[model samples]
Target chain A: MKQIFLCKDRLIFPWVRPIWVFLPLFILIMLPTWASEILSVSGFGTLGYQADNRSDVATIRDLSQRPKDGYATGPTWRLDSRLGVQIESRPDPRVDLVVQGLAYDHYKANLNNTITLAYAALRPTVNWNIRLGRLGYDAFLMADYRNVGYAYPWVRPPTEFYGWIPIFSVDGADAAYHFSGSDGIWSLKAQGGKSQVWMPINGGIGGGYHFKTDNLATLSASWQSASWRVKGAYSRFTSASDIPLLAPLQAGLAQVASANLPATSAQAADLLQHVSLEGARISYTTLGATYDDNTWLIQAEMGHTTATADIVPQGNMGYASLGRHFGAWMPFFTFSTYRPKSALNDTAYDLGATLNQGLRDPSVYMANSTRIDQHTLSVGVRWDFTPRAAFKVQLDTMRSHAPGCGLRSISPTLRTQDIHLNQLTATVDFIF
Target chain B: MRPLLTLLCCLGVCSVAMVQPTQAEVDVIVSPENPLRTVTASEVSDLYLGRTRSITEGGVSVAIRPYDMVDGLVRDAFFMNLNGMQINQVNAYWARLRFSGEVLQPSHLPDAQAMLDTVSHDHNAMGYVDATLVNDCVKILLRLGGGAHVPPSP
Candidate 1:
């Protein structure tokens, strides 16, 4: 596998490089013929400045932490700034091709995280359609357009729920069926594909990590009416990661097995395997609803994730938001929380007390490091000063009981202490 | 003297009413060739919001292509009364769908005349216009505010 160094520092596998290169070239070559009738170009972007009064680290969802460019001590533009471009060509009434690219600082630079959506759609019938290629993950209500800041009311979706799955694009095919009834429009979607997931790891010996999923499946249904929408989705994927710190632990367990300490070795192996990040099957289920009657906006989403591999914690997360429109100005409030089921316990290891302590400490630390019990409350105001643009200012205050587990930018001293952060972000979002 | 005071008050009221501009009534219109002569407010809302892509009438499915009169009181009033959403909210919804490649926004025309031309030419196209601009080429599907009525076609 070829690796691409990005963010001017990190290493990543370039799995979608070929598609990225070929798709744009194909569109450019065909642009002349389609320019007059079928080609349509559209875009949305956000320019933001954020300042946090707690830790110096700023986390963008779960992508990466901006340590070098801190949002905590001072304002940073790279934290929330992003741009996306989309090109759609519909040569026939039943067929269309869409390609979109996004540029943001997600531990990468120079458009490394581009190509968010690239798919060819076929409307076989009036009520059914199929899409093939790289499509947006539909695991949640806003999963498809989560990166488009202008689409959603919040400056950003609640990080606790939206941050769990970092992979947003799946390379595969999906089928959708639509039905219209007296109530509203209902749609059912099922997608199956694989994805390359890049998750930023903090408070670990290894500074960074990358994950890959071979089998990914998602099913979702939604009903939208004039004033209300309800949606439900479920997704499952098997993930594996490459982290350097776990190599020595694996070696130590193998050595114990060779020394004829079967009982001790078996216990150690179980502990180590449970905490490893390889070959883990993870599943996510979510239900959400939104009500927007032009004057009032109400949204709520709740999700639960279960992992077969113990390295990933089983947890539940949710958020509820309310907003009211006052002419061109809208004021909103949101409350979000994430809680893990149980802490890691390694009392079953039967090795000698000293050896057991040595092995158990690392495993317990690894498990505890992933635990997150946090709550965040946010208040914001959005001003639609123009038809195509909006200016927003938001204030967020978060408290994490699990410290480093829930909050990024965990300092050495604050790793064990409760973490509290207050952040202010102001942004201008526009579509063209 | 009482009659003179009453006459002065009437004159003052008439002048004030004359100075205030009345809001124009917006009318939703479709092509004359369309099979469905009239549309309910809910159906119009569904079509414009990308909720229902097609309308089945007389066992035939006619795909809908909704057009908008760009940036005006008529467009604002149409969306506000149809879905209770402002133009910004509607634009945001379309932006999400457009970027996700799910659906496209309605085609935007410069003014009511342009919308009239589009809806009049395409049988599947529907748009809104001021009632005064409604002509013989287009048929009124629904009336939004205070608007003149289209003469019954023979």
Candidate 2:
């Protein structure tokens, strides 16, 4: 007896309408034709459990809202459980199509299934290839299949470097050239596109930020030999976001500007101008290397980000891990760090006792919160129990020297104090 | 009764010996029509791993199709000597590349005869088999481990 009204249209259980519409359309698209063989279906999934002994909140990665309660406090399946399926059709030697869909808990509120990638690949020559559609970012190592746990060594890639750019896919095109030599193979790739970013806020209580990129361009090169690989990439993008939390700071700046306070208003205005999210440009450069000779594995990556916006702090992050394989078991240890260029300097906005504390406090807090100085040490073990499956256990200990900065989850009790979080995670990853 | 027990033990040992055949030498092979007669271990590894799909000889680029034994000790010994990697590691590597649309794993044949038949019929096809199974239809390019008896040319 329930009726849903959307505009002038009426429907029953409006949430179910999307399922009805897309399911049939998906089936129709998957049906085989004379030119296309049966659709090639492949999938990857992870079953994970984690526990943290520090705060009630679990900090999986940066951009995760705090104080909403942590999954590490209990046995939770929603933290890292995800499944992805990819369907590919190759009608000819020169052309192919692929569509991938992912179902994950952290996609966004009210959305559990989304199309992660849909692209058409064209090979004009044996050594050159082009792809158009929603494509994975080619900026960093493992960027293409970061979520597929079976492909990587870590239960999750070191969050220190991986969390810098949250956006994963770009809606555009890319071209790659491959060169083979006597000793190795080298590749150069260039991609350009725009993307939308969804960042969780307010401990994921239906609060988040949505950002749109004006344009993103990336160029990367990689060379791989029998036992060694090296990669480097550079990317730049301009983005704009309407974050509601910053509205108060903007209003305070305007108030002071109109109140005839020349000196205070000028400083506040400069701060506001730098922190504004409109048309802010961010550039990142990264280099990575790995050496794996079956028995030993060594990997290291360093990346630096330069941001024109004050709210987006400039920083460098890197990690190095060394692992050795002994039969079916591989054990590794890693060290990672994130250091922000801007320290917690709020003295510019102190503005003396003449100004209202309201105006000064918000500005000072915003500037101070941008400082991040943290390091993590982790050790893990991986057991390849089956041909297509692996079981991994990792222990990560993170220390935030800047207090409530970096990957630390800020609680009311730990706001002004340096914090350390210890987390242990176990995951079973499989690909089929 | 004692005589019968001894006979049963002897039969058991004989069956175990038959089932567990000694590891044999694996021979890299190609069709009799193939022009190339010699290949190195590294070249074979490159062709089988899909690192290079074709090789050039005498101004002609010949596309190579590789076939692998599905489950056998010879396949294991072949890969171990060529790349020092286990079958699982190779499978994992292929899986990682397959999902990205990068490279496809070689076709798998059930036994030595199937591999020999496929390689014998296609000039561009290449495979490995127990050296003892090599016949006049295919030409041996290289031998791995211990060499097997070669049949007389037709």
RMSD values, in order shown: 8.2, 8.6
Model 2 misplacement above 4 A? A1-38, A62-75, A107-113, A251-265, A350-356, A367-371, B1-39, B47-52, B58-78, B100-154
- Steric clashes per prediction: 0, 0
lDDT of 2 by residue, A324-415 (tens): 97755689999998887765456766555755366666665565565567788999997766556777899999887653345544543454
Model 1 C-alpha lDDT versus the unseen true structure = 0.74
Q: What is the C-alpha local distance difference test score of each model?
A: 0.74, 0.69
**Per-residue accuracy of model 2 over B59-98 as CA lDDT, tens digit each:** 6666667788874578776776677766556665665565
Residues A1-432, model 1: lDDT tens digits: 223323322223333333665476657744774756568778999998888875554545555434454333356787678899988887666777888888876654334347777877888887888987788888898888877888887787888887656567887789999998658889999998777644455523235566666568999999998888999999998774645666676566656655677687777767666667767788999999999887899999999999865667568999999999876678999999998777666565657777666667676666666667788999999877666777789999988875345646564455556777888999989999
Top-TM-score candidate index: 1
How large a fraction of the reference contact set does each model reproduce? Answer: 0.45, 0.15
lDDT of 2 at A102: 71
Query: In model 2 chain A, where is the ten-residue run with the lowest total lDDT?
Result: A1-10
Clashing pairs in 2: none
Alpha-carbon deviation at A166 in model 1, angstroms: 1.7
Error of 1 at A152 (Å): 1.9
